[model samples]
Target: MHAKLTTGAMLLAMSTLLLPAAAAPDWQMVAKTFGKSGTETPDGVYRIGLPRTDLKVSLDGVALKPGFALGGWIAFEPMGNQAMVMGDIVLTQDEVNPVMKKLEESGIEITALHNHLLRAEPMTLYMHVFGQGDPVTLATALHAGLALSKTPMENAAKPQASAQQIELDTAAVDQAIGHKGKANGGVYQFSIPRAETITDSGMQVPASMGSAIAINFQRTGAGKAAITGDFVLIASEVNPDEQPRLFFMHFWANDDAVKLGRGLKAALDKMDLKNS
Candidate 1:
């Protein structure tokens, strides 16, 4: 009986030794590979934003700021020993094919390629990409894809100073929104992630992966600015109607705080009704 017990104990020890050890993801390498800094969300996802500051886009004679309409972002989440990545890249008409080719050649899947707006000048397109592999490898692939376009790489050009002085109460706006925002190329931008989990393709998709509500305010004049951006949502959260709508809105303000509040509340009401 003693001999049998010894053999069983030895077998158990060997099995434990044979089991694969869990490895923590190297987030620094991912950021370095992408040529940008990143942050880890509350849901334990690492994300980086890449705004298209190179493009000068417009809609209906109004110039569209980068934060307003030309932002791209990538998110990384640990999955077992590897990592999963998802991103949406904004591309101009001429840069689409080249960037798509790069992404495809690097083993990244193009999940979607579509327009986010109509009647926009210089036509813009959004390309959604996905990959599952080493986080650093995925970032490298994304960098290569972005390089094919005019998308600025690290230190390509310093952000130009705004010619028009900002007159809006930015601090008040941030406090009212309940989140701090950053000023990028004259646009005050906020990225607020949902407090719930989002999933796609049987995998948990983090809020940083195009699942957050993006808000941008561009200073247009004294005590005035133009607000625009989109609320990212999954298919199930979208309204199933004849037009298949996703929540989106825009506002042009000129020193009218009450009017702005009312407009935003009305837009939210409409969105809630559609989703309901």
Candidate 2:
């Protein structure tokens, strides 16, 4: 009896050790599972987990930037089984080139460089960076790069907007993507299929199992075109250096050049997908 009790205690302790401290966040698998040639989803179909990044910054605390914009960048499919990144970047200022040079010197790839905003800030710039391995480490490197900027904290604010208001445009946007988009309070999003010819992470998604690009748009007014707002996309497999550049360029600098990115991302986060 004593031996059995001791064994049971050890097993109990082992089980306790194995348990995760908290429930892991359900990170939706946004990537497509493409199969071989001859079978693929339609072209221009977007996918999820294309490995992307978003950085939102503010100046003067006046909320100059938008939240959750994709920064118009994406990670390329891995090469020969290795990670490859591809995407675009829009810079805020002309001086941003020096920052890009610094990043490249630290082993990052600049896929593209440009501007999404017309005019703003101490002249912000966006750099599309690509690389592989250790997401957190990449984040660390990104944090390092951001130190070069004068933007303020990327603070997290409480969500605004309600679910009922979000449902207003669900049907309309859904029609564009060929499916019903989810309505979560203030946020409405739709993820559509990607062409089967597109493959990522050694996974072959059938035409039926294509990729998904989620768009979160907000409704600013009650009129027909009232839903005018920004759109957010999730690109999987994005590296760290690229993440910072994209975050600031695509999301943080939304003064007209960013379109509806700010309001769209904000509204989407307030939504409840299950309710939609």
TM-score of 2: 0.41
lDDT of 1 by residue, 128-218 (tens): 9999988888889998998888776554355556633345798999888899988876678888888778787778776666777888888
Model 1, position 244: C-alpha lDDT score: 54
Task: Please give the CA lDDT of all the candidate structures.
Answer: 0.80, 0.42
Cα RMSD of all models vs. native, in order, equals 12.5, 19.0
Give the lowest summed-lDDT range of ten residues in model 2. Answer: 30-39
Error of 1 at 97 (Å): 1.2
* Candidate 1 lDDT trough over 10 residues, lowest sum: 156-165
Query: Over the full model, what C-alpha lDDT does candidate 2 score relative to the true structure?
Result: 0.42
lDDT of 2 by residue, 1-276 (tens): 445558888899999999776432111221211110111124321222211123343333322323223233233332232333333343445436565776576666665565434333443455656655433333334334434543332322335555235536566667865778665434465555554355545544333232345455555456322221222334554554563445433534436745677677676687555655
